[model samples]
Target: MAESIIEQIRALEVLDSRGNPTVRVFVTLEDGTKASASVPSGASTGEHEAVELRDGDASRYGGKGVRKACANVNDIIAPELVGLDASEQAMIDRLMIELDATDNKSRLGANAILGVSMAVAKAAAQSRCDDLYRYVGGSEARRIPVPCMNILNGGEHADNSVDIQEFMAVPLGAPAFSEGLRYVAETFHTLKKILEKRGLATSVGDEGGFAPDLGSNEEAIELILEAIEKSGYEPGVDIAIALDSAATSFATDTIGLYDLKWSGAGRMRSDDLIEMAERWVEKYPIVLWEDPLGEEDWEGFVKFTKALGEKIEVVGDDLFVTNTKFIRRGIETGAANASLIKLNQIGTVTETVDAVRLCIENGWRAFLSHRSGETCDTFLADFAVAMGSGHLKTGSASRSERLAKYNRLLEIEDALDGNALYYWK
Candidate 1:
């Protein structure tokens, strides 16, 4: 019985490229039968402005320093798990912690180690004939509609200062992969044609010689609404719009000016944020919003959540950071109605699962998400559904990097008799 697990562990990390490096480790049973397992360096955030917040360096590896920190895990920790027991996941996880102990580095904080943990979990699931979501106990699966977050600055038809910081759009939750693909592609194509007719590229940033002027929030919203109506997603059913302001409201000099580093500006004023919330709800009909204010502004969030609980779901990404303390505080204070689950944010599969469970137990909506600066890993799709994430935020299914995750979810559904996921009660 354990031999099956051993073989599964051995098969981890079966894929790699210049952009990604993969490693396969077989956890051996006492009889020497190895479980197939493998680990691959997952996606990295590429050149994106949102990354500038961590430092001008692009890529998840660059801005957040995960690149430098996880680089060590590839060089060190991965080797320690070869020929280990995939079934004895606790042991493998223990090794990760022990390896990290040699130095004071946080095991989960190390991207390379976190990558290895993800691969390990994937293999472990295979041994059990379970998908990642099932393994994580996310039973009730629902495809929450996704909203588009347009990152544009003024130029051409758009302005340079992130014109419509966030927009709403949802992919049709088709029952078939081909249907989903065709729907998404045709929709984008049609959108391009219409925008072209209006002398616009239907783009967010500068492309070729044309740059879009996207500075005003009002203009941004109008363009987004127009795009939604044009794309035929308006009054969409079984779909919801999501938003990630990414602290732009505070990042601007006009409000909440603080010299504190990225980690410090958590406190936000209530009266101001509430006003913004009221204004946004009135204009956008947005169902999901992330990091609406500074992370530490607990009081402000409490007020906003109380006021907007029925109309929209206020989500916390930066606020939770995959840490239980922040999540507990949010729940206790009624600061947010949902939380975004990012594996790298906390650093390990077990920890990530724990966070999702905590969210479920607390009656908070769990949204599995990807970093803006992301690679082509498609694992989160399954994790989101299996973990009972009501929704997911990968990217527009257009970019291969983003599509990789979305497509993976479709594949999982295909394998499940077209009902591979169910919502958690």
Candidate 2:
């Protein structure tokens, strides 16, 4: 028996769904098995996330070109990683981190490192003739996540007046993952029709969700509920609502202050924001609220969690950034009851997996997420099931980039051959 080793590694600059430049990596094993992975970027990115290298030239793509990151992968990372055993995931990731030797992977670029990391995992699975979930998570990877399908978009994701970053639909009553996706997709279409009939702009945001200037956040909630009902689903019973405030987008330097430019409501204090959120929670059946406070406002997080954490999932995205240290800090401070897991935020599959494990170990819910600027890579779909995270937020039920993930989950469900277990089940 011969060991499968990395025979070659290649990288290139690719355009994400948002038309932004991103890095894609290809890994080939000695046994001729090959796998490729692309990295996604975030618009409302956290301050503490790993560095994504970009070309600073003002002439091309407004300095967003990832040619430099691509070069780093080809010239730097590939040389260091080639010939290593493809099955050694943790070891490969650790070596990449050490080679970078920066707190945030600034030298080689997280985009480059993460691309290789994910590609290697995929290649290892290919070499073993196993699904990614089985290869990465072993026998325990059976739980299919409940999709948190975003139906409406606001904040930095859209050019609209709605303040909420994302308004999502969760199919909690569906018996299978595929059925749950269908329910959400129908609701998304129904919502589009409602928006169109109301003479609202049905343009999609960066994450494939409708971006309509609905005047108020309350209106967004009402429209979503109406859409669910119109789609023949019972709101709060068959399907539930979730929100991603992305408050850091409007966070000001002054503590407890926020500038909501969209609502024309001007600046609001932390207490007022919490009160508004509480009112919504009371009025609507929102099962999850993510980043309801600014990343730097630990006190606000504590207050919000203490107020409504028991009733709804107070998830931390910018607050945690999929970093274990920050996750531990959030745990100690009672900042949030759940953590959003974005693989690119941590820059490696192993580190991302570690973060999910930490959340699970501490009884905190883990939700695998996709970036607003995404590719057609369906990695997160497998990853969510593999980790048994039970929840997934991968944009809305539109766009090829977003649909690729949902469609892949459907295929996985079929492949599971009756062994699949959905989150609702």
Model 2 lDDT per residue over 42-125, tens place: 999999999999999989999999898899899988999899998999999999999999999999899999999999999999
lDDT of candidate 1 over 1-425, digit per residue (tens)? 55433332222223232233233333344344323322322222111111111122555433433343334444566456655656565666668767776332343333545556666666666666666666655455534223232222231113344422344344435444445444444444554565577775445431111123433445545554555566665534422345565553344443443221222324444576578678877766567777666555666677778888778878876677766767888888898988877776665677677888898898887777765445566667767766756566655535466667766766666666655433211
CA RMSD for every model? Answer: 6.9, 1.0
List the candidates' TM-scores in order: 0.72, 0.99
Clashes of 1: 57
Which segments of candidate 2 are over 4 A away from where they belong? 1-3
TM-score of 1: 0.72
What is candidate 1's CA lDDT for residue 11? Answer: 24
List candidate 1 segments past 4 Å from native.
1-71, 74-76, 101-109, 127-130, 136-159, 163-165, 171-187, 201-211, 236-239, 252-270, 420-425
lDDT of 1 at 154: 30
What is candidate 2's CA lDDT for residue 254?
91
lDDT of each: 0.53, 0.93
Q: How many pairs of residues in model 2 come into backbone collision?
A: 0
